[model samples]
Target: MTLPGLDLPALQPWFTAAVPGSGELRAELVHGGRSNLTYRLTDGTDTWVLRRPPLGALNPSAHDMGREYRVVAALAGTDVPVAPAVARCDDPAVLGVPFTVVGWVDGRVVRTADELDTLSAAEVQRCAFGLVEVLGRLHAVDPAAIGLADYGRAQGYLGRQIRRWNDQWARIATRDLPDIDTLHARLARTCPPEAGASIVHGDFRIDNTILDPADPGIVRALVDWEMATLGDPLADLGLHLAYADPAFDPVLGGKAAATSPRMPGREALARHYATATGRDPDALVEGLAFYVGLGYFKAAVIAEGIHARHVRGESVGRGYELVGGAVAPLAAAGIAALDGSG
Candidate 1:
């Protein structure tokens, strides 16, 4: 039952030695994500997923697969809605780098806001509630149980974020954005003290979630644990706001128009999370600005890297043409807000 694409002769021994039916494994690429190379593997009747680093990226962390596996495995019995991790293969010879396989749950990715249009109002509300509740559960987990006691620094996390992304921009940026440096310095100067430490989803967004098609209210799995870290939980909330901010005119980037269907409005989502977590909404606003600035600054750095790659004839994808188009203005706005300008 080994799939046609995989090298059965080479993988047969390792597959057989690892799992009961590993010998019959077959795998096919699962398209949709840009970060990790994911594949769906099947052994006759049983199915699983394999995740690994992209083919030729200069990633600093060689153990991402192991890290993701460990994070998901540690939350196995918890309220977090994560796919079950089955096994991890760190031997580079097996797949050229570390990779992990997990049980493949059935669900559909919420890609665009139009997809939300098909759901009932109640389903939409439930999805919003479910997302917040799962995040709350993650933040509430005891990091000690997962051996992530040193996952991230609890104090001055915000200050560190401003500095880290600004430094990253200096390393990766190829073009001049008018105000990124000014904004970063100002944000750093005004950064408030650490609010509290909790597990933060560094890049939480609608596309990162898989929703049950039958019960749209339920989030079947929270994918992409690469950025999961120990930091201010409110930072995650702020990132969500930055992605879904309706105040920004969507006509310029079309991101807002595209997102209208997938995620709940920012106000509604904030209300839901606040009620569930018992956080005061008014008191969280100042922290929100810090996180928003951090989110946009980080995004701009990532986009600039992609744009630089494309400029150097190193990019392989189609959609990267829009990298600088969408990020530059947002980065400018972020800098403006930080500088106390309109």
Candidate 2:
């Protein structure tokens, strides 16, 4: 069977040459990912996961394979748990697009509330705190020590993020959303200074992580690094919180695991993160609303982008129809966050 975005016949020879002793390969698309296309590849004896850009990407940087490969490769020995980077193919002739292969992680991903339901209340709380601890640890890592000091420009990160997302809104918006513009203007005017720079996971949430099958409290691996960069760590926290909003439900086609009633609230997670990193609680409170608002802004743009791709028939998985409904609600939430009413 021919897989979309993967030419198995062309890939077999390259895989053999790249990783000796690997046998014939078979690929299966891993659903649920809305941006990049992920495939589970096995040669009967060995297994690996491949990630590449979507069928027709609107922004190359948003789905960069090389950037993802570089960050994951650099953080191999760090406290942050990540999949073993096996090989990277930058030559487009081989796969018709750049791609990266990592050893398949043996764990489970809880994306929707149905998946989270399998875990007990105690386990859910443990998992939530574990995720927060991991994020704190990630922000605490010294980028220079990890050879990622040049990963991104940390100065004026918030301003640049606003501009980037605003541009993205212009490109992917299906309709005029006045709240999005209002949110953008507010973020521009109230943009906070960098709350110290670190290696920020552009997207840090439960679904993006792989948890140990037997122990939900342990994170086996952190996948999806296409947006990893050095930036205000608070921005990462804000986005994480934004995903907890019920408004984000439609984007995932159902209730998100992050929004599970069993999980910790935004304040508890934020406090735990601050405690884990030895950050001042008062200081975090002072600037958190802006970051949360910014998170909503980013999420809205991303949802719109996915909807745009789906409308063009470029999206690879199910649930694309539900994503567009999230954009306006997310924008309204962002405005509320800034106004201190969310």
Candidate 3:
């Protein structure tokens, strides 16, 4: 079968040459990804995962294979659980776009409430705490020590993020959202000073991780590093909390495991992160609200981008139609978070 974004006949020789000992290849698109096009590839005996930018119009600085590969490659020996990076092809001549290949990891991805329900309540709580623990470990890793000191700018990260997402909004907005503009202005006005800088996973949540099937508390691998960068660690925490908002449900097709009522609330997760990272409780509680607001703004913009792609028939997934509905609610949530009502 011909895949939407892959040409198997053309890729066979390249994969064989790049990954020695690999035989003939077969590829299939992996669902649940709204941005990058992820493929599961195999040669009958060995398997690998390949990631590339989605087809059609591209967003500036988004869906970067090199960035994902570099960060995952550097994190191989760290405490962070990551799939083994195998090879990266930067020559667009090979696949019409840069792509990265990583060794396939065997684990379960609890993306929906139904999938999460298979685990016991205790397991669910453990899974939640496990995610928080892993995030703390990620924030503790020094960027410079991992040869990623230049991964992204740490200075003025909040301000730059505000500007960058605003630009992204302007480019992908299907409809004008005045609340988005208000949220942006509020974020700029209340942007907090960076407490410190570290390697922040642009997206950190249950669905983004591969959890051990037998033990949900064990995270096997942390995937999707396209947005990984050197930035305020709190931003990562904020985004994690933002994902827990019910407003995010539409983006994940209305049953996001992260938004499940069975899962721990945002306050619980935030407290766990603070305790795990040893941050001052009072300071984290205060600074975190702004980051949470920023997180919602970022998510809303991302949802709008996905909606735009769906409109242009560029998205390769089942739930793009529902993503557009998330933008307005998320923007309103951001405003509430900043106003101390969320």
Candidate 4:
């Protein structure tokens, strides 16, 4: 009848208007995404995934359903498998927020290290290599070719990210950490030129993808495109490799795992990507550090923003406390990445 996040009576009309015969459906929140709120909708015969920004103040640039919908829709005939974009409702009057409806993909999203253990070691290894290959594939796609030429500026990606996240930290900070500032300055100073530009997934991780249940190696859909943009491909690579850091575990809790026990080392993943794309990984060493540091800082800022909302009684869910705890560890980890110690 009613869901806390999904206002059914309000949305039914929009669904009827956009999806035809989809006004009557059951909706449930799909948990685990730390940023956007995702819901699964089914009308007993058809299913769709709906995404909207979390309720509370949000960074407009970081959480945009239109961008997510557009990117996925553009990539429909692409090697990067994504849930088919079904409809988009820009009028907030229908659901109290802009939302995107996409075809629901039936698959498993392994979100933690323990979830990776359920499969055999070989399966886990397949999952790891498969993720790497898919990322390579995504980076190989051209923004201009896909009509995404204006997704973002092509050059100065690494410098802009370092400055952007540092600026974001200033906006939603709970407290000041010297290490974060140090990392920001160091990263800014050592920022390298863009090696090349492509449509970056912005946030690429094992959990961000849906694997075919029957074949764990197959990436059925790459979900969560809220951060997709045109930028240096290595920026995405650095962020991807940063998750292999054990420090990220605190953010996801110990359940719904994505980390792999048999994951190839970060260097190995980078090398494989370089070979696959013919982009030398050596040229990116310094920029990788910058991007990785920027990743940690961005994660910390996001956590801090969520924590700030929770503190202001504006958050929904049970895990805001744990998220706040991660801000410190992530900042410390960012320092390590910047200092070349981690």
**C-alpha-based local distance difference test score of model 3:** 0.91
Q: Write the per-residue lDDT of candidate 3 for residues 1-342, one digit (tens) a residue.
A: 469888788788788889999998888999987888899999899999999999998999998899999999999999999999999988888789999999999999999988888889999999999999999999999888989989999988989999999999999898989999999999999887887899999988899999998999999999999999999999999999889988888787768899888898888888888899998766687678899999999999999999999999898879888889889999999999998898
Q: Candidate 2, residues 188-271: lDDT per residue as tens digits? A: 999978988888898888999999999999999999998888899999999998889989887866888987777889888898
Better of 1 and 2 by TM-score: 2
lDDT of 4 at 202: 84
Per-residue lDDT tens digits of candidate 4, residues 173-275?
8887787787778778877778688888988888999999988889999999998888888778888887787666656665434445467787777777777
| 134: Cα error in model 3, Å | 0.5
Q: After superposition, how far is residue 137 of candidate 1 from its true place, in Å?
A: 1.5
Error of 1 at 252 (Å): 16
Per-model TM values vs. the true structure: 0.85, 0.98, 0.98, 0.95
TM-score of 1: 0.85
Q: All candidates' lDDT scores?
A: 0.68, 0.90, 0.91, 0.81
Q: Clashes in candidate 1: how many?
A: 3
Candidate 2 weakest ten by summed lDDT: 55-64
Off by over 4 Å in 3: none
Error of 3 at 93 (Å): 1.6
What local lDDT does model 3 show for residue 26?
85
